[model samples]
Target: MNKKGQLIVVSGPSGVGKGTVLKEYLASRDQIAYSVSATTRSPRPGEEHGVHYFFLSREEFEQTVQSGGMLEYASYNNNYYGTPKKPVEEQRAKGNDVVLEIEVQGALQVKKACPDALLIFIAPPSFEELASRLTGRQTEDSKTVENRLNIARKELLCAKEYDYIIVNDTVELAVQRLAQVISANRYSIKNMKEFLDEVNKHA
Candidate 1:
């Protein structure tokens, strides 16, 4: 069997620089397909559709769930976040890595659906630093910031379940490590044993 591309699952706290790391990682690589999520939340002032997210209506989101169109999905703060199964499967079929930037709940759901997927956790240097970064952004009000911090505290518990943890102290270093993970997963011997056996037969 041919070696298939990997499904990379990434989750982190709100202020852990996950977005920056992903941006730099994408900029440096050509074969990766960043999974665009289907979300019911309205885009922010400058956010674009199909880039930041695939913005959808509540009814459309429900139809996706009902039709088994999503690999995984979850509701948070009254908004729906989901990973569309089609694009990801298509990328994998074409031997291209598909990276999913998901929350812990959705990450677990993907793991259940695709046990071969690689799970990575991106984190800040420390909880205090994460909080500082969140506050400095000025994107949300005090209440919203507090809510995210609370969720971050809960999300920290998921670290143990992840396959690898990358600290986002610097975007360059984080992107480099993420690339390494993608490369290494492609060479996983568990999936290459059959090819080796065939080579031995030829020898």
Candidate 2:
């Protein structure tokens, strides 16, 4: 019997290094599929459509949401961002673990839609560190940074709702922890039934 892939939902506050950790984790694994998100925001330099994001028009995005094609969606800074459901299903059908890097709201929606999904929350070492990371980037103004910090605080509160939390004090250690979580889940009883049945056949 073939093992079905697991759906992992990764979420965290802005500037928590969730992307960096996930990048490193995926680099070390071959069977994992990263779910690319769809957004109405303009693509930045070096970002390719369907690679970094599926850049969509407002009408297109709304149509997808209305058609129930999005796993989850939310508006940020007047732009809509969402995860397309088809790619995730396709990857899972191929027995490749699917990882989704989304915000809290989308994560929750995924949890509701797929109860077996492993919800992991990435956190900064501290609020001061989170603020420093957000400001040190120099990409946003003070007001923007403050707004992100405020949102981060609220998102942090939802961390308890997740199945696991990884504090990204160091990228290397965080990547290790994330890998361990996935590895452990892969061998979980819920995921092992098919393998056990195969063993019973040999027995």
Candidate 3:
């Protein structure tokens, strides 16, 4: 039998730099595919629909959620964000490991939906550093930034629930850790079951 791909869930607080780490890590991983999520939030300056995110309206996003098209979803900052079921399954079925860079809520939901999925949390070196990064971005207003910081505190409490937690002290180091985690998981007992079974039979 052909080897099946694994579902990787990379989650963290808002300003943890998970996206930057993932981007660098995935650059050298040809067999891994990044799962694009659908969101009700408006695109940032350089973001494009179907590229950065699906960029759906509230009604469209709710319709997908209601129809069970979303594998997992959560309301964050008054906007809906979710993983589309089809694309992820399709990529995994094709033997391409799929990674979902999502928030804590959606990551938990995915864990329930796909028990075999690998849950990795990215954490900031310190809460103060996280605050600095958020403020440095200048993307949102002061009120919004405070709201995110509040949410980040709560999200940090759930990091222990994840299978692995990597601190984003430096983007390069975080990328290295992420790659190592994925490589190790690929050969884990659970992920290698089919291959192991075949080997046992041959033996």
Superposition error at 20 for model 3 (Å)? 0.8
Candidate scoring better on lDDT of 2 and 3: 3
**Per-model TM-score versus the true fold:** 0.93, 0.92, 0.96
For candidate 3, lDDT tens digit of each residue in 1-203? 43778899999989889989999998877888999999999899999999999999999998998998999999998998999999999999999999999889999999898988999999999999999999999999999999999999999999998999999999999998888898898888788788788999989
Q: CA lDDT of each candidate?
A: 0.88, 0.91, 0.92
RMSD in Å for model 1: 1.8
Sort the candidates on lDDT, descending order: 3, 2, 1
lDDT of 1 at 82: 96
Off by over 4 Å in 3: 201-203
Q: How accurate is candidate 3 locally (lDDT)?
A: 0.92
lDDT of 1 by residue, 82-137 (tens): 99999999998888888999989999988888888899999889999999999999
Highest TM-score: give the candidate number: 3
Measured by lDDT, the strongest candidate is 3
Residue 185 error, candidate 1, Å: 1.9
Score candidate 2 by TM-score against the native: 0.92
lDDT tens digits by residue: candidate 2, 1-203: 44678999999998999999999999868878999999998987789998999999999999999999998998766688899999899989889999999888889888888977899999999999999999999988999899988888889999999999999999999999999998898887767878888899999
Candidate 2 Cα outliers beyond 4 Å, as residue runs: 193-203
